[model samples]
Target: DGVGLMTAADVSAYAHADDGGVEAFVTAGVDVRGWAARPGEGAAGVQDPGTINVVVAVPAALTDAALVNAVATATEAKVQALVEGGYDCSGTPTDAVCVVADAPGPHREAHAFAGPRSLWGARLARAVHRAVLQAVVIADRDGPAVRGQA
Candidate 1:
């Protein structure tokens, strides 16, 4: 249930895009509904506590080669830009972001899912990891009878 809200797949998927549009699309999904976007402007350092949330979606089932290539492509300028632009966090400012993708279907060519670091990327990753685990417990508790429905 909560895992749905903590999906990092998008960041991973777009990180590998050849044209480099992940930040734009991601910012749109993660920002105020009526907000605007500025080139080189990412939500790297900014965070909203409590009710805060991030949404990441990406494609899945990619070949090892493709993923390696995608990582090479995403690592250079994408991660560098944030580092240069003054992203900050307990982790490298770039650690707030993480990408994940899954491939499931009859058949298709392989694709890669890549995620670059976020400003607070590392922190977000850690938090999500823990939150996801708890969500599983919560789901089970509510399932049959663990006495939890909150």
Candidate 2:
């Protein structure tokens, strides 16, 4: 019912970032225009199909709290990318994100925090941001005829 962006198939991007000993990898698939909307700007309770999907992986082990914090950081980075790319909305209603971190080892210390200011969190955010930005740029370049399908 609205203008489409990027082809519905294989429209994705990947980005990686490293800081100190922390490393992060991000993969993003973005196909939003018909469904893009800010958190409070769209219908109050509509759960649409997920149009933007991001997967973030880090090499360092993280505590439970850090894991949860990584999710928030990634989401924020995604929103930042969308906004920087000229998208009026934060993201599609059903945007999905998955975060993965190494399992704690006997010798490895688990990080307790993964906020934007934290070392690992900062790398994760940059990686996610770069991946999302690449995806958004691809969508914009592809114009308003394709919607991420395949």
Candidate 3:
């Protein structure tokens, strides 16, 4: 048997969503090297890195807590998309995510919450979910083998 590796990203996706005056933009890339497996369910040894990277941007300012929550919210959405795509794993071990938002001005109140149930959080989740889903589809179309999988 042999492991496969693609130097470039296997698939990438982007999506945007807005609720009320809040907006979220998301971009994602996925590359699974047949190492996809549910956490704690895969082989113990380390393998070559295959990553899923997602970046989310928002135009509204948020509190520090909200920013942390946004990262969690985005991750949750990524897992949801992976599950929906029939992938048996939450994500590759090397997966990474980033969330960016405007900084609050001196006189402005930053968003206090960014949970999936919150207005802005919901928008963020939706955008991330859609983008990840799209990436999954692209990977499928390109074939699992090309993604370094069987």
> TM-scores, in order shown?
0.28, 0.69, 0.70
| Residue lDDT tens for model 3, 1-150 | 222333334433444555454444433344443334434655568755456667677778899999999989988988888768766557776666777788899876799999999878988888888777766665556534343232
For candidate 1, write residues 21-80 as lDDT tens digits. 222122111112111223465667654321112233334444565445443433333333
Candidate 3, residue 22: the lDDT equals: 47
For candidate 2, what is the lDDT?
Answer: 0.67
Task: Give the poorly placed runs of model 3, Cα more than 4 Å off.
Answer: 1-46, 142-150
Q: Write the per-residue lDDT of candidate 2 for residues 61-114, one digit (tens) a residue.
A: 999999999999988988887767666556765566777888889999999999
| All models, RMSD in angstroms | 16.6, 7.9, 7.5
Please give the TM-score that candidate 2 achieves against the real structure: 0.69
Q: Give me the runs in candidate 2 sitting further than 4 Å from their true place.
A: 1-50, 142-150
Give the per-residue Cα lDDT of candidate 3 at 117. 96
Q: Which wins on TM-score, candidate 1 or candidate 2?
A: 2
Candidate 1 lDDT:
0.31
Q: Candidate 3: what lDDT?
A: 0.67
